[model samples]
Target: MKDRLASGVSIALLAALVAGTWWAADYAKRAVKEDPPRRLTHEIDSFVEQFVMVRSDEHGMPMTRMEGDRLEHYPDDDSSEVTQFRAVSQRTERPTMTATSQHARMDQDGARVVMRGDVQLRRLAGQGRPELDIRSEEVTLLPDEDVAYTDLPATVVNGTTRIQGRGMRYDNVSRELKVNEQTRVQIVPGSTRPAAPSARQPSKG
Candidate 1:
């Protein structure tokens, strides 16, 4: 009788251990399945110094500039750069132009920049329009690409032209303007009406 009782107790304990082990395994598997993947983060030791940007011009005079720190370039997303950030000093200069602005984010793939908080652009030489003063929540810049657009409407004063548009895209490569909905472009001393290019008939040589 005593042997039978001892055997019964041992069986109960073994069964309990197996049941507990199975429950713990199921819980761990469920936890892993419900969790999301993590993003990649790289720790930057220090910022870059004197990053230069250059573009070829029609006159053979390429635009060149040396931009200082607080400037970060992330190869992943070409959409934003932290310019003139409070953490570091930033500066940009060119032969024909020198401009300064605070808080800039440039995209990696696309030719776009989001300048924030007291943004300014200037031309050192050429016309009397020495500077472009802009105050906006955000300003998009496609400098050489001439393809800048914003989600929110912006007030821009570039040289003699003042433009108020919901969004604007200028293709420097093609020299064309892609105005978004409710766009208002005013060329100083010129009419605001859209011009139709003269149609040409095909000619046989």
Candidate 2:
């Protein structure tokens, strides 16, 4: 009888141990399943100094050229930023466009660029249109569309004419410029300043 009792107790202990191990394992699995994964932090993954990037046309001609003192890329948003940024766009038979700023942020594939701090934009003379120049604290450029705009106060100069407004939009294709609220126009009587020097073809870097 004592032997049978000992055997029964051993069996019960072994079953309990097995059950406890299974419960612990199950609890651990559940805990792991309930936990969330760690996310990547926003950081710069790459950077370059004195860099230049060019986008070419189907004919292998450089259409848009960009250069800067420094370029940093953020993987979190897939954006690139440049310091002392400069860009030029020249299409076949289209007016040459140029932009410069203290800092610039470029979106995916550089389709859109946001320029800040003493932004300067220029549309050189072409197709009988006078050269257009703009000064602002910020500007957004769409290189492919040949468009630039700003909501901040801006000053635009065309030949002897000067325009000031709080918001401005310019389309190189249509050669249309529009100024929003608080628009001011000043036209100095003079022969449109001699056409701006012919734009030099941008060279690939």
Candidate 3:
């Protein structure tokens, strides 16, 4: 009877030792594990300099191209900003257009670009379309739609004729330029609008 009791006691102590060892191992694992960190609202995800990105249309044609000296992306806001930025639009219905700005903000999956600080936009002469140029303090560009607008003082030139306005919206699809208020008009009398190409069109850059 005494021998049986001694054996039982030994078995109980062994079980407790195993249980304590298991618990200690689990505690060690949990103490060393760490949780993932949460991102802040303004946290930046990426940054680059002399960056270039090109986007294509559904038809596999290059639709928009963006280039900049510096680019920054914020994952929290799902937006991007660029310094010394330039963008080019290549749409089938319109001539290739280029825009330059000291600063640019891109949003909504790059469908919209807001350009600031000495914005200049130009459309290369092509397909019988004369060269068009615009200079403004700021301009909003929609690359997919080939549209641009500005509410600040702006100057637009077609050939030798220049028009100054406080605000304007240009739609490449409709081939219309709407001005909110006309400020001035300058024309060189001897110079005429560039004649549309005949059978041969000028090559565009």
User: Which candidate has the highest lDDT of all?
Assistant: 2
Top candidate on TM-score is 2
**TM, every model:** 0.42, 0.73, 0.73
Per-residue lDDT of 1-205 in model 1, one digit per residue for the tens? 9999999999999999999999999988887866566553443334565455555457655543324355565433433355662211121332133334577765644344566776443333333323443334555666564333455565555555555656544332332333354356466676443331111321110
Off by over 4 Å in 2: 1-38, 190-205
Writing each residue's lDDT as its tens digit, candidate 2 over 1-205 gives 9999999999999999999999999998877856467565678889999999998877788889999999999877889999999999888767889999999999978989999999999988767666789999999998878889889999888777677878878887767677775467676766543322211321110
Kindly report which residue stretches of model 3 are placed more than 4 angstroms away from their true locations once superposed.
1-39, 192-205
- 1 or 2, greater by TM-score: 2
Q: Order the candidates by lDDT, highest first — what do you get?
A: 2, 3, 1
Model 3 Cα lDDT, one tens digit per residue, 89-134: 8787777789999999989988889999999999888777668898
Number of backbone clashes in candidate 2: 0
Candidate 2: residue pairs that collide? none
Clash count, candidate 1 = 12
**Sliding window of 10 residues with minimal summed lDDT for model 1:** 196-205
